[model samples]
Target: MSKLLKFSAETGEKFLTYSLVSVGLGTVIAQVAPHVWFLDNYAGLFQLYKKGFAVEVPSHFETMLSEISDDLAIPVKNPLTRLLTVIGFDTMHFGTTSTTSGCFIGIPVNFNYKSEKDIDKLSIQVGNKSVPWDSKDGIELANSLILSDAAKRFGIAYELSLVDTFKFYLHCFSGPVIVIICGGVNNYFCNIFGLPYRPFPVKGVFYGLLIAFGIGFYYLSKDLITTYYEMQALKNVSKVGEEYITGGLEFYDKLLARNKALRNLLPDGSSEFNTDGDSIYLFRKKHVPITVKKQLLEKELEKLNHSNII
Candidate 1:
């Protein structure tokens, strides 16, 4: 095999160079390709057109998206923001979009049910004990999962606002940016200290540290971008109207309650989620907590109420 192609401690520089390029290309493909190839081309594969849900849910979402499309400057009719009902996903949110066409949104199939009986099939079953939909807590849980029409539109609007900005492209490019910066730094230091010719142990430790640093940098950037853009989306959603402002408050409240219910119902609830219903993150959190989200909307409502009283 060629010297660069051979896998050995002697060819550390070649390995490092290949690793950096591989990671950079991998990140770009993972982030951008799914939207372009899968979502835009064959979104119908993931779309749920169940007997009862086919007409109502998608039609409502399309109408809601169109109503706010002008205000948000997102196109409604052409290159449509497609809708799909995802089974495993328990909430509604924005999915990835194609750079060439438009974006898509995912709604949890469970979110389509309005009453307790309607969602019984999806109830949590731990061993033999099933979470009943008729009990007082069960009724509350059911109610929490189903949002008012106004709250539903607000949720859709929030997801729409998320894609309305240039943040997705920025997020996609972050992976390559980190790869370039880390690779450049490593190469600079290697040249200064004489790298590939250095002892095996020294080179190993140096490469390992650089890899760790790159991973840490990736996660930190990901968290910061998520936090900032989510807050910005909420701010944009608040501009729609008074009903949507009220809807935002209700949406978060219902989300928190649903998580609280899940915590009580599921077998591993306590470990999986906190008291406030946010996931118990091992390292960094990727989204705003439900409690904090609700509080922000509540503050907006308070301001609206005070202004009206005057």
Candidate 2:
């Protein structure tokens, strides 16, 4: 019997360790693989390029001002363009560039609209470097800035719109996706050679299938091995608690029974019985009186209350 008990204990420990190892390995693989392959390096590069392009509008503005001033003697140098350029350069150095910069920079500058009737009244402050220009004539100024006659003829708003769209895709989405795909493929290949891992041609499909199977097993009648053990431990503790409660109740019930028996033995009209706090066993005679019968009942009640019966 002792040998059987020892063998069972050893087997249980080994099984528990194996289960822990499997769960630990699976969790580490799932969490680390995705971030290392697709999320970190690829996402990081996309963010860097976006930051580099965040001050693209300000740069474009500077170029337009330089070109327009050269042709029309307007002296349109924008201080805002210099500040934005410095900010963009600093962000690129820090490696903290992302899509958020575009929103922050673009939204502030484009907040107000240019009214058609008040085009002459609209003036943009470039910086201390250049004079503010009437925004009503911004299209013509933009056109003058362009080197290509065809491009200049099309108007500044058209050119700016096209440039803005191109920058958005290059900085925000396309650049990031391309970088992510390249890094993911490279990492996947590296993992095959470096780790105890094999290459899967249809990894996405297989991963989906594995996840579905795991979920089904967790939800369906199949064993929830870890949860089952936890429940079993709780059940054991509940059983111990119930035993203690039952034992306490049984003791209380026996005490009540003994008290009732003592009350029955007491004389109905006796002075001892009439008073609440009086001990019926205290009135002792050399010969057992009818009151002595009550004393014996009291003694039995005390014994039952003190003894472990249940």
Candidate 3:
């Protein structure tokens, strides 16, 4: 019975010693572990998160637009077409010509007159000639064609802005959290071994848990941060959309006002002017000499090219 008691006491002491040693070692390792390779791989996690956010969010936004367009039976091939359709145009024709200087010039004109009578009565002319085109179908087609194209283009720009915001959030939030977790894990691991020696299976298990805890903490923090920023970005986008719509209305109002003012400058009963505020005035006047402007431009370019101050 005495021998048994001595054996039990010895066993107890050894267990306590082992436990203390293991814990001490674990604490040290946890502090240094983040500098190791496993933590380094966490960078890839951040990269993945960033890339995933970028790919998914924009795709989702586009998908929503596409579905809406499809449901409305709107053509989605060219955003402009979809915009035109939304604005109420049945048919649209758009064409562009390019200059030798690589500039593209586009001429877009919408016609609402469906019948010869409407065309003649409207007195609308294009390029010094009255349009042989007319429609009794009302001006909805022309208005729709113009508005739809504008709207689609605006939508594209909005989508791009959303994408940029998403990317910014991913980089700012996910990236830093991943880096922090990786760094912490490495620091913990390096502290684990005070001396160079092989790690036992049990020690390895504890180390793995420590790393996991660090990584888990980082992920949770990252998720929270990302969500917060995403919400903010979404709110901003909503505001941006509202602003765009309001601005568009204002722009059209100003444009129409300017057109009206110009029309008032024209002579009454002139076929060169239309009630819809379009003008088609042409005069066979001699071209103003371009020599002075050309000379001035040439001198400026020469000065710029030869400037020693850089």
Best by TM-score: 1
Model 1 CA lDDT for position 133 = 68
- Output the better candidate (2/3) by TM-score: 3
Q: Provide the overall lDDT of each model, using Cα atoms, as 2-decimal numbers.
A: 0.72, 0.32, 0.36
At residue 160, candidate 3 shows an lDDT of 31
User: Considering lDDT, where higher is better, how would the candidates rank from best to worst?
Assistant: 1, 3, 2
lDDT of 3 by residue, 149-252 (tens): 33333333333322333333342344345545554554454457521122356546755675576556554654555445434433333333333343333323
* Deviating ranges (above 4 Å) for candidate 1: 1-10, 40-46, 49-58, 92-98, 122-129, 134-137
RMSD for each of the candidates: 3.7, 39.0, 25.0
For candidate 3, which ten residues in a row score worst on lDDT?
A: 96-105
| Model 1, CA-based lDDT | 0.72
| TM-score winner between candidates 1 and 2 | 1
TM-scores for every candidate against the unseen true structure: 0.85, 0.17, 0.25
What TM-score, to 2 decimals, does candidate 2 have? 0.17
Q: Per-residue error at 14 for model 1, in Å?
A: 3.0
lDDT of 3: 0.36
Total clashing pairs for each candidate = 0, 3, 37
